[model samples]
Target: MTTTTSQATGSSAASDGRGARPDRRRRGKEGPAVAAVPVVPAPKLRRRPVLVAASVAAVCLGALLGVWTWSSTSNTHEVVALRQDVTRGETITQGDLVTVQVGLDPALKTIPGDRLSSLVGQRAAMDMAAGSLVTAAGVTKAVLPSEGMSVVGVALPPSLMPGERLLAGDLVRIVATPGQQGDLGQEPPATVAATVVGIYPNGENGETVVSLEVPEGQAAELAARAATGKVALVLDSRER
Candidate 1:
């Protein structure tokens, strides 16, 4: 029994020694290692470059806006030459620029160059076609003489179209003579002189009426001539 006990005690001591050796070796090899913890992510190196670019762009934009504001505030421009139609027909008023048939000198019937400045605001003599003449009568002024003259509606031949050539004031002779005589076949021609006040053309009825202003006493004879004999228009010479 003693021998078995001694062998058993010796085996246990050997086992304990072996275990202690292994534990000491393990502790020495490890050398007090610390527990592993979660590592923080490194910051992106590209973020610095992106932030600097954004700052520069913002500064540039601010500078550009400042420059634009300064230029607009101090800018000065001339009031370029502005030509507008001062006169127009009854349908037109001031501050209106309508494409009208302006008059050109009759001598310039055919233009050598393509530019035709004079034919801008002239109204048509008749219902104008493309190649028609744009005379002074074509376009009408938006205004008229309020106090100096007036218009009268008279029944006259259409062939006697005035083309609206009568101006503000004009004078001529008015005649009213008996066409046939009672004694024989001859009668003395009678005539008188009056002033042209206005011009009225009847497009619908194909009639041309001349508004005239003359002595009040001659209104009777003038009306009589206008009613009986054919009314004739004679333009006064510039000399008179």
Candidate 2:
């Protein structure tokens, strides 16, 4: 009975040793067990149609504005302008005008630069300052000394007239002054309404020769008073 027990123990020990060797050999060949790493997909890019469209529209509008600005600045017109000051009824001349380039509205009445010849002999209808644009209604062909009007030349000393410079279209009154002998009459001073036509220097004397346009009926009387150097000029309201 003891010999049978020993043979059974030896057989069980050999079977256990064989199972342990196979597991050790498998572990050595396979190396250490590693945990798997999870793969993450790349994040998808979201497309915003509104943002893209706005960018495109902005670029187009910028280009359009640039083009419009360039076109507006390039567009210009040649027109007539005054090179010097011209008084009312003064004849327009070539030397009095200049050709200028401007971007003007169509509603503005400006004379064309090419029509300078047509305006040379015409008269100014109103007072025009230097560098002013010439207009159609600013010139005329009417005679200067109109019907029923007479122009009288009056030479006045500085004391007889205002110190202010007088223009051609200025309204004035020629008032008769008392002579050195003095007036014996008690009547009010005789005053004649007149318009200044032109002004000229009276040689070396400190006197101004003013051409006065008055009614034909008053011309002779005004001339007699002016010749005596006993008249004073009073400026009237210049407003039209």
Q: Give one clash count per candidate, in the order shown.
A: 15, 0
Instruction: State the RMSD for candidate 1.
Output: 15.3
RMSD, model 2, all Cα superposed? 8.7
What are the runs in model 1 whose C-alpha is more than 4 Å off?
A: 1-154, 158-164, 177-188
Q: TM-score of every model? A: 0.34, 0.68
Tens-digit per-residue lDDT, 105-158, candidate 2:
988999988988889988888999999999988998876568999999999989
The list of candidate 2 runs beyond 4 A from truth reads: 1-62, 87-93
Best by TM-score: 2
Put down candidate 1 lDDT per residue, 95-167, tens digits, no spaces: 2222333333445343222223333332222233333333345444333323543333345664443444654
lDDT for every model? 0.51, 0.90
- Ten-residue region with minimum lDDT total, candidate 2: 176-185
